[model samples]
Target: MQELKIERLVKRYPGRDQVIAVNHVDVEVQAGEMLVLLGPSGCGKTTLLRCVAGLEDAQEGRILLEGQPVFDASSGMNQPTHLRDIGMVFQNYSLWPHMTVQANVEYPLRARGAKADDRARRAAEVLEVVQCAHLSDRIPAMLSGGQQQRIALARALAPRPKVMLLDEPLSNLDALLRVELRAHLRAIHRELGFTGIYVTHDQIEAFNLGTRVAVMNAGRIEQLGSASQVYERPATEYVARFLGIRNSLAIDPQGGWHAGPTPLAGDLGRLDQHQGPMQLYVRPPSVSVLPADAPAPGPGQIVLSGARVKDVLYAGGEIDFVVELGQATLYATMRVGGAAPRASDPVRIQFASSDALLYRNGQLIDG
Candidate 1:
């Protein structure tokens, strides 16, 4: 069943010049599925999420939560946020510093007029679930950042909302805590099976948590698919770049490849049917940088010579080689080994054709 649905959503901001924050966006989230809105800042992801929560009134759109109309611009019906019955977790934790953990978790239930006994029971249950029952008497100021966020999550879960909206809930935590909390969040979602929409600019978090990821760009969804699908085969150049496919080269009709004015050396075999100018994209890990005198790669690999290693960055167990090929620069990631080339050293770059993606007019070409 569809838990949440959005249709023809358009949100515009008034200023010196009109800015469209969300433009004709449509999305349907299935029951018990966690849909992640992944994008950079100012891409309208947060605005869209707020619209769903009834925190922002969209100029044009119809939003349905559990088959009930929460917002319909055409009918002039905009339900208030409290009446929408949603649980939201913000990046700032948003916990009441003066309230104890138990009180903080029971506030929503109290607002809804839940009985005192019911509220107490539910608060205790959720705090236990979030593994913070021991800290129930402690105030937000007495807890660590992670503990406070967990209490915030417990509060959100106490209401048993129809849908949960998480706006970068883990963004403010340290890296290790973020990872730990991500695992906890995923585990909780699986155990409870609640429908949720999570927003984040971090790809790693999106990939780790989302059942389906929607990549947003410039107030539009550029691509939407499974994490593997979006990561392995991005639909557009923007999605490709966002997913870290940094080595992009242009290909001409005669099968010639070039990075700007610098011509490249590669056959890019089996390009007879792809017409006109096309772009080839490969991720840093897929490209191999070796000494200029290294032997040619095996079959099905495209090799480019006359490249120079301009810089090398040590990334603990891995090395990032910045190679200059004529006017173009490409990055290659490899494990730290004895054969690692230093800066200003001559090098060659090679990658498998199967690992490369071909695009024409910003769309992937089916081989």
Candidate 2:
């Protein structure tokens, strides 16, 4: 497996004082592993991927594949995309309408001067790997969306590139097809042991596919870690909220915050020392909904009594409730088929201190 490294990478488009698309960012990927660049639109994830693919020249820093220099601004060295030994699958399946699936897949191998028999054999092998061998003779216009995507994958893999780059490869498919293709892609990766870097704004996809997920925002990497690490312990409020954290309550200076009628324990004084007003954040799943008649037990627990359920959404494995606590509305989730409270019925919402995260001025406080 080859190691891919980016050292102080930067990309700036020429404009008034230069528009910085990608700032000084550094990342390293181990060979035969999948690393995902995850963020919202225009967060520099795509720019970084293009730089590593040698499709874009970096204005600063360097890119190295297996210790071989691919891009270096100081040395004025930039390899062309075709010579980078990288396969790219774009969001749009760039299949040729004039050519059949077999011809499209064989084009790359043929361009490299492989024998016609060898190219045909390799094309068949890659198409089989992508599970599109059956449709090799069919034109992309006649194929389903998923089938076309698989053909694109087959084409990308036909040349057996050392690095695989995917740019939101499943975004074009339907939800069901996306899930199915995701499984197929992972299985193929395991079979080939290919080094890959995936770029996507979907957090769930990043969590499921990435060996390490790097969260980007405003042309900067906010956090980089394992799936659970980024979800459970985010470095900033942007990361937490982006990951779908819902409940946020103001913190008092006395080291606690009111959750309706109950005070939740937190280090508000320490949080205030940072900047802006102190607030507490909690994920929806972490908030527990108890029976209204339940006994009040334990200290440092924030329990909101008399919260009326405003609405309920039936998710697959859980039920999401929009509960009204006086004038404030909060969301909570509970396991489906376990126990359910009726809508418009009063319920007690309880959450532990450990589940609450402190943030001040849109930034997470170090606890």
Candidate 3:
């Protein structure tokens, strides 16, 4: 097990002008732990990963493996990919078309000058670890996508590299195959306890696989924390809105909002520190709908009437409803076991003060 660290990493392309792909990104991966670099497309996650793998020459920063510097631009020290002792699994399964599975798996060991018998034994062992030993004689074209991926994984691991870099390894597979391969990848990580840095744009995969996820945007890390921490307490409005949070309403500290017969209360929270107008964010599941005839709640809950259900969608386990409150539309998701209201029916909507996050100018503000 070896720890990986990247400090002040910067990658820029100089042509007629300059294009900065990775902007001074710093990342640390604990030994035997999986760290995921997650973000939207073209956010420099892949570029950063390549730098760590010694595949790309970073214009700045230092890459350290197990406390030793592998790359230092100022010192003019940059290790080659093969000499860095890192395994790379690309998005495209980089398998040799003419070679059998066993031959491909044995290639890495052979390059390291292992004996023929030793290479064959290590190849078989790694294939068994990836559960592809039975198809060791099959060529690349004879295997399914998932099977080919397993072979690629086996080849990467056959040499027992100090670190592993996976670049969207499951992105090309179908949804079902992707899910199955994700589970297998997680299992392999657990069994081998190898340091891994995985890059992907899929939030589901990041949440499922990453021990700690670093959310990136526009070539910078927006937030880095556990999955639940990032999801529940997003530091920025971009993260909240991007994560599918739908309910956003502007709030005024001076009691400025008026919705039909109900005047928006000024007692929600103090928005004095926030500049300009303030916005409130709430998850769909936090908002609930009550029957029109139901009595008002006691305290800390805003009760809005005259809301008509605009649509009802029945998902697998939950019933989602779109409700129109005054002129604004809000979504509420209720479990299927609960009673669902009909569309176009007037209902009272309620939400807690704590469930709402206050934001101003696209940034989260303390409420």
Model 2 clashing residue pairs (backbone): none
Q: What's model 3's overall lDDT?
A: 0.84
lDDT per model vs. reference: 0.90, 0.84, 0.84
Instruction: Report RMSD for candidate 1.
Output: 1.5
Which window of ten consecutive residues has the lowest lDDT sum in model 2? 264-273
In angstroms, the error of model 3 at 90 is: 1.7
For model 2, the stretches where C-alpha displacement exceeds 4 angstroms are 16-18, 253-262, 265-278, 297-301, 306-308, 326-328, 336-346, 360-367
List candidate 1 segments past 4 Å from native. 255-267
Task: Give a tens-digit lDDT track for model 2, residues 247-293.
Answer: 87764544344544555332234343554446678899988776688
All predictions: root-mean-square deviation over Cα?
1.5, 3.4, 3.1
lDDT of 3 at 313: 93
| Candidate 2 Cα RMSD after full superposition onto the native fold (Å) | 3.4
TM-score of each: 0.97, 0.88, 0.88
* Clashing residue pairs found in predicted model 1: none
